[model samples]
Target: MMNKTNKILIQWLSWPIHVRIALIVILLILFFGELISVIEPKEFPTAFDGIWWAIVTVSTVGFGDSTPKTHAGKLVGMVTILIGASFAASYFAILSAATFQKQQAYVDGEIPFKRKNHVVIIGWNEKAHEMIQSLRAVKPFKQIVLIDHSLKEAPLMENVHFIRGNPTNDFTLLKANVKEADAAIITADQHKNELDADMQSVLVLLALKGINPSLYCVIEILTEHQANNAKRAGADEIIKTYQLTSHFIMSSYLAKNGLSTIYSKLNPATGNSFQVLPVPENLVGKTFKEASIHLLDQESILLGIKREEEAKMNPPLSYEILAGDYLIVFSH
Candidate 1:
């Protein structure tokens, strides 16, 4: 049934200009024709007869079977024919103008700011694309907004929206509804120089924080030096792309075949990825060993505790779980 409706719609849309105009004219004629029929039912006996007379009068066909006898019926027929002729002539012109408006809407970009509890990602690059793809995997149910001036249209993704404008601009940011987003990821500009791009990201961070002071924002910087500045600018978390990998690579090179590959597999995008779970209220005071055993029993491996302001990896078995602590677990 849906396919048949779709086919009919497609056929109607694909009809030539003259055909569409004529169809609309016929519909308008029928409407006024029915109204006239109701106003003077005795003159035009049936509704179909009124419609037939209206069509013939409009088209100059002059079929004698249903001619109007009274002055009122003649007036109705004359007005219907005039309206039908004027509408048919102007119909195609209005259609082309509306088509142009729709095309321009695409070029200008559209962002539905009503979207709430979604992730806003600023900037587009290899890393940003990877982040979006990874987000689709890990956070499939969540909406993602892409803000960039370069993109002409939205990326072909089900849960993603594209806002074509500068990320730092308040108009663009507001269009993405950044203030209401669950979280935001600000990435550096690859098109510009390294330091300049980092500065732009810092400026954007300040703008976002200015709008919503409590918003959780994760920022990407080129160098380790900018991490502190980004934090000062109101970044909740900062990822130093170059510096982070160097330390891991050095550790792997210095030590024997160690945990680098394990870390590589820890991407949240994959099915078997590291996840953070809250300390259960019932087991808030449980020992690390007890928590580990409980989680292991549930087929998840307990890795460590992310306590307030600290990360305790492989804590002593007797270490008690704190109330505000987060359990880092690896799930398959």
Candidate 2:
């Protein structure tokens, strides 16, 4: 019996500190309540009354409705006040500390993400920041997880969960719950040179695909040559940053305000932006011109058709739409 009792006590002591403190607080109240009721039955008529008095006295909310008349009961009350108050204070203090520690861990990016189907963005840069902001503007409630090893703390943004670790590491990807994520974006590391950045991005893409082959990955490659490597690594879409930037710069040079015009059209706040949608069943077997006319009535402009892995912008008017093709449109 003694061994069993000792084992039980040891098991209870091994429990979490907050749980132990809470249990101790409740036991203190019950033990003192029963003792005072037995010592002064006239003052505390029942165990319930003694418990009510104990609660009131322990909380220091002394109501003069109940008082101990005998010296023994008064001494019990004093002991209750001393021991009960200490346990109560300790419980609250531990609770507050635990809350603060959890919050601090989150800010420090030490907490792992537990939610599923979130968009995970790898690397921290101006492009990543803008992408996050743009995503928030488009879908206010969408969950986003940002992974980067360079950051000391998570960025302050709504619906953005940050994981501080190398994107190439499987452990880091798991920390962001990448296996359950809907999609992932691998941004080229700005700190490295063009070739090195593209290599790093491809490595991260490979890691992501290794963990979740179904994860739709969009990777940015600084060099055009690395785009094929990114595609070979299971990237669904590869953004050639240098080529696009050069084209945009050239366009701006040839036509004043070209860059600003493009930015304005792409801005979510403008309510006129690009959207990729599955080809409607009705649109299948129709020509590009017919699809354009059909979409025009709905205030959307058909810009391109994404068939399988290729996106042909402004295809010939007589081009026929297929069943599995996706339509790229500029919507207002």
Candidate 3:
């Protein structure tokens, strides 16, 4: 008994086979007519007239205005017409299929973005949603594409495109437009074994980098050791999930009551209530007092300034803000 999947596969394969056959037949008849015409000059009135005679004969649209004189030429023209008719039929079928595919993709919302810049999120996990929310918060305008093995349901958010397949699969990534994506964030594949997560992440990063060397990628890892391995695997950033959660829990305990509120609010929840705004390099020479106007103008509070591998939270009002400072800002 043939499985349903096998039936569907056969149906899909048939279309491509038909198209290929049509292409081959079209080329064969076209070349055969050209060769026969070249060999029989006296039989054709002129080159253009001969080509016209060939087209009409091969197409089975004999108008009788131009006919092959020699018996051999007439016999060849008859055979060529059958071949050309088959070729024309095949060409029409292929053309119709190509048009149908475009229309179907549009109807199904599978159209590619014209801008060609997007962030691709590979694999699915609880953390994947969090990362998406974080990215949406930080970069609201950024285009995001999600790829997963089982996308049974549509994403909760609007404009987040989905391509259902294995992230490590080259075809899947290509469908997600990974080559043109500005960045790719790969979360740990929860359905697979933990040991395999790092390997899969490496494969995905290698695939993307192989396509576009400058493409940036961030991989989520379960351990610090895996983080190091991922970095070596060409990850621009390796987020250690365990360490981050540990820090959060510890900080939450220390804060306890209202202090915990500060920690919770400060942590990137959804793209909604909190965000970090990197201070512009142009403002680096000035102090907080100088750049405070811009922050105030934006109606966002500067929680602190992160500069040169250090964070000075609630820096003194007089603190000097240097270049490369990132402002931890909170928006109500």
lDDT values for all models:
0.82, 0.91, 0.72
For candidate 1, lDDT tens digit of each residue in 1-332?
99999999999999876568877888887886787688778867678877877777766667777666678777877887688767755776678776887656644566346778889898988888988888888878889888888877767777877788887788888888888989999988888887888888898998888777888999989876777799789889888877877878888888768768777576777677777778889779999999999989889999899988687899899999989899999887
Q: On residues 162-266, what C-alpha lDDT tens digit does candidate 3 reach at each position?
A: 676666767777777877888988888787776677677778878878777788888888766667778877888778878888987887787776655564455
Rate residue 90 of model 2 by lDDT: 92
Q: Is candidate 1 or candidate 3 better by lDDT?
A: 1
**Tens digits of per-residue lDDT for model 2, 194-287:** 9999999999999999999999999999887898899888889888888888887888888876565666567775577889999999999999
Global lDDT of model 3: 0.72
TM-score of each: 0.72, 0.92, 0.55
The CA root-mean-square deviation of candidate 3, after full C-alpha superposition on the true structure, stands at 10.8
Ranking by lDDT: 2, 1, 3
TM-score of 1: 0.72
Weakest 10 consecutive residues of candidate 2 by summed lDDT: 257-266
The lDDT leader among the candidates is 2
